[model samples]
Target chain A: MTEPLATGSTIGILGGGQLGRMLSVAAARLGFRTHIFEPGANPPAGDVAHAVTTAPYEDEAALRAFANACDVVTFEFENVPTAALDLIEAQVAIRPGREALRISQDRLTEKKFLESLGLQVAPFADVPDMDAMTAAVEQIGAPAILKTRRFGYDGKGQARLHKAEDAQTAFADMNGAPAILEGFVDFSHEVSVIAARSPAGDVACFDPGENVHRDGILHTTTVPARLNTSQRMDAVLMAGKILNSLDYVGVLGVELFVTSEGLVVNEIAPRVHNSGHWTQNGCTVDQFEQHIRAIVGWPLGDGSRHTDVVMENLIGADMDRVPEYANDKDVALHLYGKTETKPGRKMGHINRIVR
Target chain B: MTEPLATGSTIGILGGGQLGRMLSVAAARLGFRTHIFEPGANPPAGDVAHAVTTAPYEDEAALRAFANACDVVTFEFENVPTAALDLIEAQVAIRPGREALRISQDRLTEKKFLESLGLQVAPFADVPDMDAMTAAVEQIGAPAILKTRRFGYDGKGQARLHKAEDAQTAFADMNGAPAILEGFVDFSHEVSVIAARSPAGDVACFDPGENVHRDGILHTTTVPARLNTSQRMDAVLMAGKILNSLDYVGVLGVELFVTSEGLVVNEIAPRVHNSGHWTQNGCTVDQFEQHIRAIVGWPLGDGSRHTDVVMENLIGADMDRVPEYANDKDVALHLYGKTETKPGRKMGHINRIVR
Candidate 1:
């Protein structure tokens, strides 16, 4: 096993959004410093991180300097530029490794990966051109989602086709990029399993959190998800299988569709997930700390849920309710240090412990 | 009631130690920024705070800039220079107010304040010189302790007089500083009440925590202390009385000696206390967040403990055991990010939840 990082060692994080900001705070709590490398100026993580490199990913000198300053590197988002990772990986160790990132960065690859593991996934077909898109529509059927193979998030880079007649328009919406046509699964509900894997191959998963979405954005995630004993075990076992298959180290967020037949894998996020925010209030150690521990080669913390929690995202104007939450006795508010509250932007979240 | 601080307002902290570090993290979670003004270079809080002014308190220009940048000012340590406070108070509001600081900064004033409130305190006599020391011994009797009136902590600036013959040496040990002689209170154990008071006069107190000290320094603090329901209620009521009497607007740690007659007030710290660290794991809002909420004029959070936790300090060489603790599933480790760990210096702490 790789040696654990010593106290005071710096961890290089490749994104400066809310995820990175929370990760920096957790790293600080564990006596480690975070050096954030983000192209955006005055990023939120810069407010809490020990250092920040405000240069584009293509800036080789900047990447070299950041890598040299850190003992290990980790990314807050799976879509981090490959050129940047190649430079950083050559200089320092990157936790969760490149394989996990490669598989999750593309929709077609991720779906195939799950299928290879004997995990159920939505019926999908690769559509590289108009002809392929037509064939995919015939195979995958209607009521499908046409998503760009790479760089899609928060409902962006996606088009829905209600029937075979809409396939041509949906393919045009892809803007000539490679796409994947996935048939919609008639699932009862969606749930996410936040799992962590240490360098020593120890895997631990938090209880599944039932999720609700609005306008293609996550609205709320409630713990003690409507899952029976067998379903919970199934989720945990599948998450462990994925971690071991990829030889992954760090926290991974596995989104699943709870269908009548069983659990179907939707996607995986190879970093701290928003659905896991309830762990901050419901468990002894939150997912942020678990991610840090995994990257640093420390033992994974217990992921047992001790209380029932419902985490609601405060998107944009939802921040108007801050006063009410501030007066709440059971609510734990976490606001990202964003200067602007643009429409649809995530401003913060509230984890209210009901029990 | 004073106006609550706006979401993006910056809170200025006087000392950038571990308390300030934790406070900065809490402030960030609440969507507030923190500017840390620390005389010492490379303070731990600097890593997490939005801004750090590394100038001595005597630097008028630095002090002015810091005060102008903040919406309100609060301190982690009680012994802040009065002159610095005078300047800052002129620019921004300082919570817990001057009265609380003035009373707690001096041993004699704090003891007298408690006595005036009808709270029990050890019999104490003022000792300014040789003659007064002799008279104090006669009044307070032997088997007493002589302590400097100001700037004493962790058993420093204290001398024990076991008998009348030992009084002379003990008096000479005062080093010309004004002192107070207190007859020791024979107690069962020591407990501390962490209480908070908001600007609107709302008061809340966490359950008393039993404390264990080694070398006159706090070693561990365990929640759900060994106290009957009546004793617990008595402690909370007295804490509320003190907060109301002072018209306090922040967290206060009240140390008490549980004697057979009643609970004797040992001293009061008008800021977040070390013995309250267990709240980080056991409460929805920890002492640091409670202090920030009180200072910012917001409604206080719930101080109820949901789990039993034992907070053990990792001082100096104790950090060597960090690896072991890191491997423990139930242990929540907090490291101060101190570069050097000298003897008796608090490096970090571990909050291990038993249940």
Candidate 2:
């Protein structure tokens, strides 16, 4: 048998957001070196990685160099271009490979893929134009969301259709981009299950966390999410189905809307998620490290939550209150080193472990 | 009052070891950047810092530039030169300042300082020469340790005196350096208290961890150290006293020997210590982050452990077992990413949390 990826191996990470930043920190903790590849100046991951490549995604030469430097490659965000993946995969093994990214990057494609797995997703229909948008509204009805098939995150590239006239306006604003109309489910609450699957087929998952959102951005995620045993099991089963189907390795966050009928998969982020931040303080192994171990081909760690944890996002100006939060003796303030904190920017987060 | 240190402020760190590496990671989490000043290539902290100055301590021009680039400076090891500290202090604020370093770098001075604080230390006498060594052996008897006053760690620069006749040989072997002969304390155990004190006089300490050593290198540290309530309280009090007396503003590690009578001061590490590694997985806020907050004049975080933890060091050959450890659940492995693994060198560590 081939030798397993050993200590001192370098892990290449795509994207340099806070997720990549935290992932680099976790990888370092596991005796693995991390090299970050991002197309920006002073990215958060740049501050913690062994090396960083600051060339644009189109720079095949730099991408090839980064891939050659690492034993295995993983991404922090799912929107990595297909060309970038192709360039890196030519030289280095990319975990949670192209199939996983292909399915997750598009709203319509992801929903269809989930349905193919016999998973329950919100009622969705593809809309190519204003006429189709109107037709989709008629089929999915009012209170549905029209989201671009590609490049949407934290509620961006989305528009809610409260009235029929809003559909045409939404379509025009979307620049006639391919879109999907998702029928809004009257959910009792929202929750996310973050799970990791190793190349060795070892799957470990943290407990589902209850989520609350502000302006479509996640506000707080509390563990022991108000779910019964069956609900909890359903979340885990859904996450596993997705990972197994995609032959995925590394962490995938599955957001679900808990309707009165049952749990409905809202979206699948093929990487670490904000809701999993609670694991940083509550679980024996945080989601970042779990993702690292999974991509590195190591057996997954114990994903058990050791404490009752509540994680709050310090969006934009909310980071100013870190000092006040630091005094509570109950909260762990974590600020992402982002220089400019504009409105809706995710600046940091605070994790509180309740006794 | 002056403006609080804002996000993006640079924190300069001296001595780029694992402690510095972890400290840089923590500082980045706070929206603060780190610049590491060390005299070698691939120093541990250099892997994560925003900037690194690889120059000797005597490179005053480079030192000034590093200090100018940082808002404040701190260190990860106590043995950094006094002149180095002087150069940085002349240009910027150095937390846990020069006085703390002066007392901690030299065993004789540290012992005397502890004694002056009305804290109990092992009985000791300064050894200026072979005659003084003989006199110290006569007073303290056999089974004592003859240690050089400075630049000793992991049992280096120390020799044991098993008999009265060994004093002359031991002293000569130490090259007649300024030394101290310490009577070994008949201790029941060894424990360490890791505490952080901010400039505002706020002090917070994690629960003491009982330490076990092998070959004079730390092997394991367990939290909720098998100490009674009284002893735990004593450890906390002793650590706090040291922080307050030194006007220290950073994390301080106080190693104490639990003797038949009570806890006796062993040696203090002015920065994060190996024994505190368990806090990364066990506590809401770890010693590294706490140190970052303190030195930046930010409020201190909670130093409470949420679970019982055991931290094992990955010294030299032990690093080879990292793959096996990575596959194990409940283990949080941390490697320094050092290129070389020389015999007896500290490569990394792993913390296992047992609830």
Candidate 3:
């Protein structure tokens, strides 16, 4: 934005899921308006958004109107089609910039970008076809995971190559899509840093949170993660390096594999991440607001941890425990207003202060 | 409210000011939708609410439609017309109940109700007319304040009787309105306890916050008020007594005057009060969510304080310092999204965590 978005300025959010819902609330807190653009009917974010346009990204007319209405545009979905962004970017600035999105959209490009930054990353080789898969397995060995280069989330579009003999099967699972074989790196645990950088180059990172995965989906993230002083610094420094390198101007979630060697970059999300949800209860300015502040060119709030927090995602059936959790002291619930409780769907989350 | 309002159920709010705006955001956080029934065009709450009914309370059709659309209804503005409420209450549950609203709507009734509960309120007597004013001043003595029995707030509709001779002028200031005489009490400072009660009779109270007012408007509220343990206990007990007496099923704010003799009941606000704004940063579940939980039959989230906080109201010109406050660490800004900065109008507030 040429200037910090003034109070009542509209912020256009790309997707209308939980993140957009929260970003909308945070925008209201900061005196800004939010307009959600999503092709879905009755999007969760629409409940809180000032305006919502139910039109596909391909609709240039809708994109133009949305772009014109917004002071600045940002996204919850990283895989927004390049053509849609091209249309919107022509009218309004898209925060985190196209470079961050371009690099993070494809796993292969993201790995190469992180590797080029002299960052520690999992061993990987691009597998264009079955022929390349053979070479990738020959180099990366067994127990590697074959993942599609794009549109992969929550363990989707991925297959495990448990042994050298499983390469063909894993390759077949890709369905002729461009894939990458990631070599296994044994790690004690996983952690993520949620950080924000203003357009003015000021950066702020919330304390890293230790994460646990259940069925390949994020189950819980506890703040004040068990990391030595050096490990914590390494994690934060790595986040700053990536943010600065990408000229990022919004919240970015960097997942790290805490290995014996050092912190390895597992992946990065260009928008607010579920792992940062604990900040809602643990910090004065949570990750959602921090992202709004950054994208608007306002100084980032101090997201430094105040209290230890454990954020647990309520996926599908986990939502049934809401009443039980509501009775728990020091627990703050952040549920998305979704009508259905489909399995594997993100229902909501709770941030429990670990007193 | 027969049972906990299921996710996606709409909660109708009676006002669309800053408090209603915050309440809407809180409701959305809990997976609930909000419909704001506000007469004003483009109210602040409309920015975050799922629906906005722009119709006056006198419009029975609008009230009926709004009531039919909501599962439960509550208010941010306490002075909602009783006629309008009677129409809507027939269709939906209005939380905190009509009893709380009835007593609080009038200064005389509220004070007498407190006095009947054995609460130490300021010395007062009815002054329904100029003829009655003389007897009231005589019984209550000089140096008292003449206030309208109904529709008074923020030091409005009040005149000070500094001496016995000032009674006629003070009484005349009432403009033939039903008035009450309040004998001034010796006090050091003011404080308030934000408390909540559920239909099941569960009561929870946040710590008393010492309030400082300027020009008859709340300026700041500092948590961990300098109150003795006995004083704190008395405040909480007083709140519980008031809540139970009226069958109040939502958050209530009880303002008190700390005197050498004891804590005196200054006044009570049946809805969320500005003094409780600090709870947004100091407690796990803030007053807005607590109020929502209570009205919806959901268990009240624990509101016990976790951090020391000082909430300062940004009224009128105070909004100019927003950028400064934004750069300050540990300060959480809650701007109202008001388009204009009118003198004496509350723009927003800041919760500064006093670490």
The RMSD of every model to the true structure, in order and in angstroms, is: 1.1, 1.6, 1.1
When candidate 3 is compared with the true two-chain complex, its DockQ is 0.85
Consecutive 10-residue window with the lowest summed lDDT within model 2 chain A: A1-10
Q: Cα deviation of A10 in candidate 3 (Å)?
A: 1.3
For DockQ, candidate 2 versus 3, the one ahead is 3
User: In model 2, which runs have C-alpha deviations exceeding 4 angstroms?
Assistant: A1-3, B1-3
Give the alpha carbon lDDT tens digit for every residue of B1-355 in model 1.
Answer: 2789878889999999999999999999998899999999999999999999999989999999999999999999999999999999999999879999999999999999999999999999999899999999999898999999999999999999999889889988989999999999999999999999998999999889999999989999998898888889889999999999999999999999888888889999999999999999999999999999999988999878889999999999999999999989889999999999899999999999897
How would you order the candidates by lDDT, starting with the best? 1, 3, 2
Per-residue lDDT tens digits for candidate 3, residues A1-355, read 5688777789999999999999999999999999999999999999888899999989999999999999999999899999999999999999989999999999999999999999999999999999899999999998999999999999999999889999998898999999999999999999999999999999899999999999999999998899999999999999999999998999999999999999999999999999999998988899999999999988999887878999999999998998888888768899999998999999999998887
State which docking tier applies to candidate 3: high
User: Candidate 3 at residue B274, lDDT?
Assistant: 97
Model 2 chain B weakest 10-residue run by lDDT: B1-10
Cα lDDT of model 2 by residue, A188-254, tens digit? 9999999999887767789999999999899999998999988999999989988998888889999
lDDT of each: 0.94, 0.88, 0.93
Q: Cα deviation of B275 in candidate 3 (Å)? A: 0.6
